[model samples]
Target: MAVKGHGMEVKDHGMEVKGHGMEVKGHDMEVKGHGLEEKGHGLEEKGHGMAVKGHGMAVKGHGMEVKGHGMEVKGHGMEVKGHDMEVKGHGLEAKGHGMAVNGHDMEVKGHGMEVKGNGMAVKGHDMEVKGHGMEVNGHGMEVKGHDMEVKGHDMVVKGHGMAIQCHGMEVKGHGMEIKGHGMKVKGHDMEVKGHDMKVKGHGMKVKGHDMELKGQWYGGKRSWYGGTMSWYGGKRSRYGGIVFLNW
Candidate 1:
């Protein structure tokens, strides 16, 4: 699953796990924080806001929103849109941070294009992602800071927005290929196309299959890991290929 900056923790998943599902922590998640922490499968935060969708989906945060069957939400201004959706946030809709969807197929337009599907495409500020397989594109792209390391293989990054095409996922960064259990991360923005990818970061998008996305005006020195690079705060590690991605 895709995991954004200080996004969802494994436990924070609202949906109950059943089979092969890796029990992704940050599927369809959004977060903004300074310091980060992950406990069990939950991301307890002290940031702007955090959201997680699951079985009996419910979320809490400033302008937080969750949508699904039997989805009931509670917050100062929260919203959950679906057939059997319920909410308690009085100003949720007014804030425009709220979300709406039917049967999981989502396509939000205008304000901030936040679309959801097997081939998810989002055009907005955070560019968040959710589910097992998805993609996100935004303006805050890439991880650029001191101590950021990406080793081994081809780490080529050249483009504006990060995109992931199904089957043959072609990234714009240095003509990289993450097809077979490979992970591609350029600074903060990344595109994971393989079945099993492992990259780490601090909060924003969450797509299944071990992909993480984090967003911020300024990149922070944090450490976290999955299969390849782990995310940390001013932390360092040794890998294979060392490439530089500047956005």
Candidate 2:
């Protein structure tokens, strides 16, 4: 039996540690560890329930469990969970159930996926994609997919009922119904509505009516109602018979 502390070093028979290093061989296994240097934190346990913590976390055999607050790992068995994820792979096995991803930059391997995008690379299983700049490869696609690399973005993806207005647009479809403004759509079932258009800063404000032009966008001297206007050289003002053109 032997014990040592404070920048510890221990050697008996089945256990050996140098500085803050650790080793537990077999027979009535016991270990307590801490490290900052001296092999810069190393851990080793031959068998039976093992526990490891921080700065290069390592665990071997006997129903392994690992938790990391920051990098470095070596494992014979695996289970992982991440937030603000970054990876280095070894024997990777993945399963995502009812997957929903919002605001995406994707590289996916599929099962059941629901995606909302920004620069995409997808592999399909049960795929549903909502758009902005896309590159897709298909499997069992239930696609509401769009890619012409949208600039000045305004997007709407609806599987049932929808209403839309724009600045820069990208839309993907399922069962789409849109009340318009310079309409562009991908595909499914479509409907669009637009009447009289004017846009400079673009305005639509109506509450209890005083100058009713209820669509969307308002600021400084009224110019909104209905939808559809892309700007350049603006003039056509009388509140609700809107038309302004540029290019």
Against the reference, the lDDT scores of all candidates come to 0.24, 0.22
- Candidate 2 lDDT over 210-241, as tens digits, reads 11122222222332212343121124432223
Per-model TM values vs. the true structure: 0.23, 0.15
**Model 1 segments more than 4 A misplaced:** 1-45, 48-64, 67-114, 118-124, 128-247
- The residue ranges of model 2 lying beyond 4 angstroms of the native Cα positions read 1-46, 53-57, 61-68, 71-84, 87-106, 110-247
Q: Kindly give the stretch of ten consecutive residues in candidate 2 with the minimal lDDT sum.
A: 105-114
Candidate 1 local lDDT, 1-247, one digit each (tens): 1111212111221211121111113333322222112233334333332323221112232222223221122321122332211222111111112121322212221111111111112111222223221121222111222111121221212242234322222344322234433334444434343443322333223244222233321233332222223221122322222422222
For candidate 1, the per-residue lDDT at 90 reads 18
lDDT of 2 at 33: 28
Per-residue lDDT of 185 in model 2: 27
